[model samples]
Target: VKRIIALPGEHVAIRNGAVYINGQRLIEPYLSEPTLWRGMTLDHEYVVEPGHVFVMGDNRNNSSDSRVFGAVPLSSIVGKAWVTYWPPDEVQVLTTPAYAFQ
Candidate 1:
């Protein structure tokens, strides 16, 4: 699965267990449960550098993403996953979330 959270030059931050971009809180309605982000970066504010992105897994507790490996270069992203067909029983088309940025 590929997650495109923060883009180059975007400011990402975590406060009270939620994500904020460019000082606006991001709304992720697709999440099955709330995210308790405890990533490798503890600076509170993460300014995504040029040609890089910040990635993370839905299962924050079990995911090791850019938080651990640092920002990922834009050149490395292959593509986005448009559908989910795993677990056999659970399969469906994926739609992009409309994050409420304030």
Candidate 2:
């Protein structure tokens, strides 16, 4: 449902159709396609305020998230989607992606 993009105090921006943190680009190997942001206007860099997190949708261009609603308060997070239940044969557990900004 939601993908955590940038944590509090981190800088988040969409540049050249890719996500960047601080001044380094994030390696998002899990994404099947590159992000195509089309929701809100991100003409300027965004700095995540304390106690807030920047989130996005699995479907970037069509999803509304922090880019549209602004950063979400950390306290709003209740749980993470850990597994898929549909398609009995395709059931599986999901783990958060490890990002290395470089």
Candidate 3:
């Protein structure tokens, strides 16, 4: 699963291992490490289409998400993340994070 980093019409960029949306650095408290990989759309400033959103994996270093595939069409998203069952110890219901853009 991936986190939606940019909304429709928003500009996204990756620099110095951080994500910027519309020129504002995104505050991501859930990331275990900084994003170290780059991809086609995220390599430089990219504008999200009106019907698309930019997504990224929590484990940025190893995930092959929007960084590789580009912004995902909103209609293409089939399901929401419901729970985390892997590793047993961390199993729990998932909730959408609230983001405050400055």
Candidate 4:
């Protein structure tokens, strides 16, 4: 699963171990560590299409998401992830994070 990083018509870029939206650094309080990985999109800036969204894995340094496949069409998303069951002790219902674009 992936987190929607950039909404339609938004610009996303990654540099210096952080994700930036438009020209402002994105405030990601849920991330366990700084995003230091680079992939197809991380090396440059990209704009999400009108019906698409940019997605990234929570495990930034080890995920293959929009950074590798480009933006995903909204229609392609079938469901919202509401629970995480892995790692046993860390499992719980997921809550939507209030993103603060810095």
Candidate 5:
């Protein structure tokens, strides 16, 4: 699963199975490939509330995030994911999704 690397008040959407923030598609070089949108709604637009953020997992088809539990308030954010100590090959420092901040 991918961690939420960005915050609220940003425009986001999924198209052609790719995620776009603002107007450009995010180059998620880490993703296996284009993801599938399952159990995700594209009908209603969401404006993230102040001090809150929207989060989702990389496994879009199996994630239960803002799409299910709704936006997460900043106070609820336990902490930033700082490392990938497990699965040595996948170990690396995570970066925020750049496009999300555009």
Candidate 6:
């Protein structure tokens, strides 16, 4: 799944299938083109509310997330997803993107 690379109050957008934040393109080396945004419901015009998170899946086309159900309140985020314990090949510690904190 994709991570919460950016948070509330951050401007986010998808253009030509690439993600950008605050007027800068995000360096999502993990993703390739054809990253489908099939089920996304969060239009770029919507502002992420304070204390809420906007999340999407790595497999963009198939995800059911904030883009569909709207931003997730920070209170609803029970904990951070620290590791991928399942799928041996995908297991690793999660690193929040640096731009996410800007």
Order of models, best lDDT first: 4, 3, 2, 1, 6, 5
RMSD to the true structure for each prediction, in A, is 2.0, 1.9, 2.0, 1.8, 3.2, 3.4
Per-model TM values vs. the true structure = 0.85, 0.85, 0.87, 0.87, 0.69, 0.72
lDDT of each: 0.78, 0.83, 0.84, 0.86, 0.65, 0.67
lDDT of 1 at 57: 88
Query: Residue 86 of model 2: what lDDT?
Result: 78
Q: In angstroms, how far off is 97's CA in candidate 5?
A: 6.5
1 or 6, greater by lDDT: 1
- What's each prediction's clash count? 0, 0, 0, 0, 0, 2
lDDT of 1 by residue, 1-102 (tens): 547789999998877667888988888766666555564454468889999999988876567887667789989989888888988798988887766875
- Give one digit per residue, the lDDT tens place, for model 4 in 1-102: 889899999988888778999888989888898885464544688889999999999998899888878899999998899998989999999989888877
Q: Which structure is stronger by TM-score: 4 or 5?
A: 4
Q: Which ten residues in a row have the lowest lDDT in candidate 6?
A: 34-43
Write the residue-wise lDDT of candidate 3 on 1-102 in tens digits: 888888999998887788889989888888878876464434678889999999988989999887788889999988889899998999999887888654
lDDT of 2 by residue, 23-54 (tens): 78888776767675565454457899999999
TM match of model 2 to true structure:
0.85
Clashing pairs in 5: none
lDDT of 5 at 13: 68
Model 1 off-target regions past 4 Å? 39-43
Task: Write one digit per residue (lDDT tens) for candidate 5, span 1-102.
Answer: 436634678666666767666646677766676654445565334566678887878666677777677778888777777667779878888666554322
Where is model 6 more than 4 Å wrong at Cα?
A: 37-43, 95-102
Clashing residue pairs in candidate 1 are: none
- What is the full ranking by TM-score, best candidate first? 4, 3, 2, 1, 6, 5
Residue 69 in candidate 2, Cα distance off native in Å: 0.3
